[model samples]
Target: MLNTQWRVLFVFIVLLIASALIANHLTGRVFNYHDPIGSVRAIYEDIKTKIEMAEESELTAIKTIAAPSLSAKTAMQKHLPQADTTRCVDVSLGKVKYKRNGNIYTWTDSNGVPHFSDEKPDFEAATLDTDFVEPLDYFELTLHAANLPPSFTEELRIKLNTVFKVYGQIIGVDALKKVRLNLTVFATRRSYEQAIKLRGADPTNTDGMYFHSTNSALINYRNEQSAMRTAVHEAVHAVNKAILGSTPRWLNEGLAEYFEYTKNSMQLVSVEPHPGWVNNKRVAQSVFTINWLIGLDDTWQTGDDTKLYASSWAAIYFMMDSNKGKQFLKSIMLAEQKSPCSKLTAAELKNMLYQHFPQLDKDYRQWLKTPFRKQSF
Candidate 1:
C-alpha cells in the first residue's frame, strides 16, 4: 500500500514538472534555439534525480510516523498504578490467635517436600519471617479487646478491610489509600459505650459509630455477626470521609448499609435476599424525596430511624443497579475537599446530582416501586 502511494505521488510529480518543462522549452526556443535535445535530456536527468531523492525522503517520513515507540509505551505504563494481588486481604495473619512472636516455623519432610506448622523443630527446620500485615500509610485499626477470640477478631478485621477494598475499587485506591481511618474494637457493650461517651458521642441506641472529627470508627461487640456488620458499616464511613471528605447523609448511610451485608467480595457476591433495611418495606413509604435526600446536609433528626435508613439504602440500591446510576454515584464521589477539611455546598452537590441523573426524583421513586429483591445489585 505504501509503495502504491509513493508510485502515484511520483507519477503526479513527473506530470507537473513535465508541464513546467514544456512551457520553459517553448520560451527558450522562441528566444534562441540550439541543442534542444541535449538541453531537454539534461533537464530530464536532473528531475529524475531530484524525484528519486524526494521519494526516499518521503518514505523515511512515513516510516518514522508509522513506527510505535516501545520506550514511550513503557514510560506511560510506569505511571499507572499496578495492582498488588497480595494487598487483597480476605483474612489477616496480623491478628495472631496464639503468640509465636513475629516469625512462622517451617520444615522439610523426608520426601524433600515443604511442611508448615506453628511449632519449631529440633533440627533441619527453617524459620520463615512472616510479619503481620502492615497498615496502609493512611489507615490503621486497633482491636482493644482482651476477651474476644483472636480468630474471630481477625475475621472481623478482614471484613472491614474488604469494605475498604470495595470502596477503593469504586472511589479509587489512590484516594482511599490516603484515607486516615482509625478503627477500634471494644470487647463488651459497656466498654464500647464508655469509649463513645468519652468521645462525646451519645451511644444511646447504636451498635457502632464513626466519629468524623477524629476520622475513627468505634464498635460494640454485641454478637459475632452483628458486630462484624457494624464494623464493616463504620469502616465504609471512615473510607468515605477519607476519600470524599464528607458525603450527604443518605449517601453515607446507604453505602454503609450496602457494605454491611455484602461480604468478602467487591460486589454483591451472594445477591441473597436478606431482611435488611435495603429490603425493608418502609423504603416505599419514605418521606425522603430524591431532592430532599440530595439537599440534606446534617439534620439527621428525622424522627423515624427505620424509614430514614431504609430510604437511604433504597436510594443507593437504585443508584448502583444500573451503569448510568453508578456513573451518577461516581460523580458525587469525585467531589473531594477543596480547602482543608472543607466540603462542597448543598447547592453544588445538588447540581451534580441533577446533572448526572436529571429526573432523579421521579426515577428514584419509580425504582423503589419495582420488585424488591433485585435491589441487591
Candidate 2:
C-alpha cells in the first residue's frame, strides 16, 4: 500500500509540472506569461500596427479619388485644338465686334484717335463708329468689372491688339483673327481669392491664374501695380494655348515672363528685365544648366519655381538678343510645327539647339553672367 501511494504522488507531481509548462509555452507566443507589463506593451504595439495600416489605406483611397480629376484635366487639354506655329497664322477668320459693357460708348474722334467713356461724350451722332469697328473679333474679351473707368477696358483692348501685332511680327506669322478671352477684374482682392477657390485652384502667393478648365483669365485691380503685367502674362498663355497648341512649359512660361514686362509703344514690342530672373544671376549659374532647363517639364513639377523661371527667362533673353539666336528661335518654332501634339524629347531638343548654335550651352551661360542691356524682339 505504501509503495502504491508513493507512485501515485510522483505521477501527480509530474503531471502538474507538465501542465504549467504547457500554459507558459502557449502564452510565450504573445508575451512573457509572468510579465503583465510586457503583455500591455505587446497589446499597444499590435494596436499601433493596425492603426498605421488603416492610415495607409485611407491615404491610398484619397489618392485614388484625386486621380480621376487629374485625368479629366488632361483629357480636356487634349480635346483642345492643337495647332502648330506654321498653321497658326493661316487660320485667320472674321473680325470680332465689341460687346460693350453697360453705359460704355466707344468711338474714334475726327483725328482717328479712339476713345471710350462711361459718361456719354458730347460728340456728333455721325461720328459714332461703334457699329463698324471689328477689332474685337480678333480678341474676344468678357469683362466682369465694376467701378472701373470705361477707358480701362478700352485701353486693355488696344494693348492686347498691339500684343497680337508685335508677337505676330516676331514669329513671322500672321495673328489669329479670332481669340476668345475672359478677363474678370474684381473690385476687391477678397472677391478675387473667392473666385479662384471656386475654380478649385490655390490662391496663395498668386495674383492671377489662367484656368484651363474654365478657359478664362482672372485678376484683381486691388494691387494695380502688377495687374497689367499679370493680365498680359496670363493673356499670352491663353493665346499660346489657342495658337501654338501645348507649347512646352519652359517655352510657354518663358514667353509669358518675357512679355509680362513689355513696352508696347507705337506698335513695337520691347521686353524689360524679369523680376524673378534678372537680379538672381549668380544663383542661376549654379542652379541651371541648358540641358537641365530643357529637360524640365514644368517648374511646379520639380518645386524649382523661381530658378526655373529665371533660367527660362534667361534662355529666351539670350535667344532674342542676338541675330543667330533669333534664327534659332525661328528654327525651333518651325520644327515644332511638324509635331504639334508630340513633344520633342530632351535629347532631341538639345540636339536641335546645338545644330543651330553649336556653342549654345556656353553662350547661354555667358549671356546670363553679363548684364543684358536690351532684349527686343
Q: Highest lDDT: which candidate?
A: 2
Q: In candidate 1, residue 123 scores what lDDT?
A: 78
lDDT of 1 by residue, 165-194 (tens): 555445554444444445677787799889
lDDT of all predictions: 0.59, 0.62
Q: Write down the RMSD of candidate 1 (Cα, Å).
A: 24.8
What are the runs in model 2 whose C-alpha is more than 4 Å off?
1-137, 175-177, 280-287
Tens-digit lDDT track of model 2 for 15-81:
5555445445543434454774555556556666767999988987786576533333122111111
Provide the TM-score for each candidate, comma-separated.
0.56, 0.60
Q: How many backbone clashes does candidate 1 have?
A: 0
All predictions: root-mean-square deviation over Cα?
Answer: 24.8, 16.5
